[model samples]
Target: MSDDEGAGRRPKKQRPFWQELPVLIVIAAVIAALMVNFIGRPYVIPSQSMEPTLHGCTGCTGDRIYVQKLSYYWSDPKPGDVVVFVGPPSWNDTYRSNRSSNTLVRGVQNFFSYFGLVPPDENDLVKRVIAVGGQTVECCDAQGRILVDGKPLDEPYVQKDYPWVAGQNAAYPRGRVFAPIKVPAGHLWVMGDNRNESRDSRAHTSDELHGTVPVDNVRGKAVFKIWPPGRMGPVRSHDPQSN
Candidate 1:
């Protein structure tokens, strides 16, 4: 056959944008999704429950962080890890845990809510960790502040406007918590950086005389925030930074 005749039988040239572009994009998105869903995630701050450190009232006052789920795979939840968990009890006297909610839905939300993908639950609460099991956390400072391991903590993240003042007012009128009472082998004592507003383990979980959270109750640690461009950053412990 002649050279021109053979050339005429060849296939037509493809476009600059190959038809496979869609498939490639889908694959890339899937891989990214896998990394986000199972490897790391972001936690959104819904309310002022975790104020100062994480202000969520003024609009986009939250963070977008790479939450390492694998951290808990080897070690237990530390005293400073801002964990995301299911509230076993009604945190506020005005509200209670909804009964109709499905565990499956709750679990899914917990996984993707940080990516602006979905919300874990309408009642989710985010608070700072005050102490782990058996750590005595008392509000004995004349200024209504807290101390750990006999050392006075310095927290710059708290609301300066409400700096734990006690000179004019009674200190810890709510009552002093004599901790280090052995928070069970599998429990932890968590609190919000904003001592006055947070209804942490000190208030609700202590009714049973056990000032700690059970290991089973902990869902996972909040490593970072992925929402509110301005309020995005690592979810660090207020104790260490100040101390």
Candidate 2:
């Protein structure tokens, strides 16, 4: 074909940047929303509650984790899964009491939270599931180990340097030595690996559910840690059955 004819068949000129910007922005926003709402979201450890297993200490860079939102839809949370959830009302009262009450600051934080750049909710927490539904959970057997359904758990993940103890003055004072309690239906008993610092279900025994978190409150399972290149990998958990 002649040069003139070939030129006429060429692709149309690209749109100007100004005109394309809004469309690109909308597309980006939609993709981010879908990923954060349905697929997965990023969450930063805001406290040292999870310590040696998932660092989040003062003056230290916390671990950023990716939470998979779809898996729980296929199956209920199993014992040993590291999961995240909105803190129960009673739990939130203690944990989020210091969260900013300023609407403007909260608005900005919520916007970023939607993309998993921060925690999805200020009151959301992460912990390992110790028992589910009707299982009985208690701490500190003769060996100072957690027992589930009358079987002692073989937890290699509990922070060891920080010893586990029982009684009112123990590291996990509130949860250190609790009577065996049966988890109600659709509830989970969760605890932090850094038992010494975490304020998990064990710390709220006086609440209506007796410290068990409702299954519906769970957001998802934390599948991996994706921050600080040096500390990036899958988040591991021990199987109760394996014990």
Who wins the TM-score comparison?
Answer: 2
Candidate 1 lDDT by residue in tens digits, 129-176: 666665566554666556665555565665633444545444433533
lDDT string for model 2 (11-116, tens) is: 8899899999999988998899889989888888878888788989878789989999899888889988999998888887655443359998878877877765
Query: In model 2, which regions exceed 4 Å deviation?
Result: 1-11, 97-109, 161-172
Q: Which residue pairs in candidate 2 collide?
A: none
For candidate 2, what is the TM-score?
Answer: 0.85
Candidate 2, lDDT over the whole model:
0.82
Question: Which ten-residue region of model 1 has the weakest summed lDDT?
Answer: 171-180
Give per-residue lDDT, candidate 2, residue 87.
Answer: 84
lDDT score of residue 237 within candidate 1: 54
Clashes of 1: 10
- Residue 226 lDDT, candidate 2, scale 0-100: 99
State each model's CA lDDT, in order: 0.60, 0.82
